[model samples]
Target: MADRITLTGLRVFGRHGVFEHEKRDGQEFIVDITAFLDLTPAATSDDLTKTLHYGELAELAAGIVAGEPYDLIESVAGKIADEVFAKDARLTEIEVTVHKPSAPIPLTFDDVAVTVHRVR
Candidate 1:
């Protein structure tokens, strides 16, 4: 499917990092999701039941980010992908991006992010 549904810059506080202070203090995490599906059903039927609900997807991402403490953003993104696949069977493809603005890096940078793309 060429149609895409995208959610960007979703902020959630999470204790996910390699350092102890990072896990204890916690930091903000930004998530972006792009899900691919056939929009024809929703377009023709004019019913939300025919399409993926974005609000539920956001909650799933937030729940994962706020629930567990992972040492890597890769793991976080992977979990998000797993949730997306589990939540809806109609989704043909999904891309999840986890952004860490307050990483424990000594050097200055704009942001650090991990993006995972999955296809069913």
Candidate 2:
């Protein structure tokens, strides 16, 4: 199996939703990205440089989400997928989950989340 690194529960505040208020006021969003890449070198070398830095990636993602205000979560998820690929070319595949904890819905619910997978 290849090396797998997962960044979980990365929280960010962004304007992403179908509602008008959601786009204007924004909401809390959670991002979870699972990356699959080669780990043989990092395993043997035990060097930080040899492995993917998820912290950096998460920060970059946050910046992007904060910068790019998309109307829908789907666009946000797609941007994240594109951003991850731009950050690390070695990432063979990535699974991205975007969660809207404060969705403006009439019914009571915990949150609304969307997950997407992209292969490079």
Candidate 3:
């Protein structure tokens, strides 16, 4: 298995939902990304170029989450995975998790999330 670079609990605000109020008012969204790649090159060479820059990855994921609107968190997670593939050719796999805490559910809950995995 490849080594992993994981970024967790990135919070952002977006207007994404099936309901009109949710779309208009917006809500907070949390994102987590686990990117799999060979860390041997970076570890051996001690160079930043040998691996993906996690800060940039987080910014990209945050931009995707805060920029556009999607009815489903699954779609959000998939798009994030696609972005990771587009940006990093070295990554072998990626796991994206989108969390919605302010979802308009009438009942009580801790949180709601969707996770998507992609491999290259």
Candidate 4:
């Protein structure tokens, strides 16, 4: 699809890490989702029903990020993509990015993230 809807900087708290401390003390996770679909229908009709409701999409992704504890953010990204695809059939493709800013790395880094792309 040529048209897309994107949501960025969605922050959620979750206990998702390999270390025990990480599981015990949850951290924040940032998520970004890009949903690709034909926007012609919605644009032409000027109706919300013809397009994906971004608020609902954000809620769906936020639930996943806050609900599960995964060893990897890669898994988190994949789960978001899977759930997003399941929630909306109109989307032709989706890109999910999970950011771990407070990752337990020994070295100083600005951020750690994983991105996944899925096509329907």
**Winning candidate number (lDDT):** 1
Alpha-carbon lDDT, every model: 0.95, 0.83, 0.91, 0.94
What is the clash count for each candidate, in the order shown?
Answer: 0, 0, 0, 0
What order do candidates take by lDDT, descending? 1, 4, 3, 2
Best candidate, TM-score: 1
Residue 63 Cα positional deviation in candidate 2, in Å, after optimal superposition:
1.0
Residues 1-120, candidate 4: write the lDDT tens digits: 679999999999999999999989999999999999999999999999999999999999999989979998999999999988998899999999999999999999999999999998
Candidate 1 local lDDT, 1-120, one digit each (tens):
799899999999999999999899999999999999999999999999998899998999999999989999999999999889988999999999999999988999999999999999
Candidate number with the higher lDDT (1 or 2)? 1
Q: In angstroms, give how far residue 50 of model 3 lies from its true place.
A: 0.6
Residues 1-120 of candidate 3: C-alpha lDDT, one tens digit per residue: 559999999999988888988888999999999999999999999999998999899899989888888888898899999988998888899999999998889999999999999988
Off by over 4 Å in 1: none
Ten-residue stretch with the least lDDT total in model 4: 64-73
- Number of clashes found in candidate 1: 0
Q: Provide TM-scores for the models.
A: 0.98, 0.91, 0.96, 0.97
Error of 2 at 115 (Å): 0.8
- How close to the true structure is residue 84 of candidate 4, measured as C-alpha lDDT? 86
lDDT of 2 by residue, 44-113 (tens): 9999888888788898779867776777788888888888888788889988888888877789999888
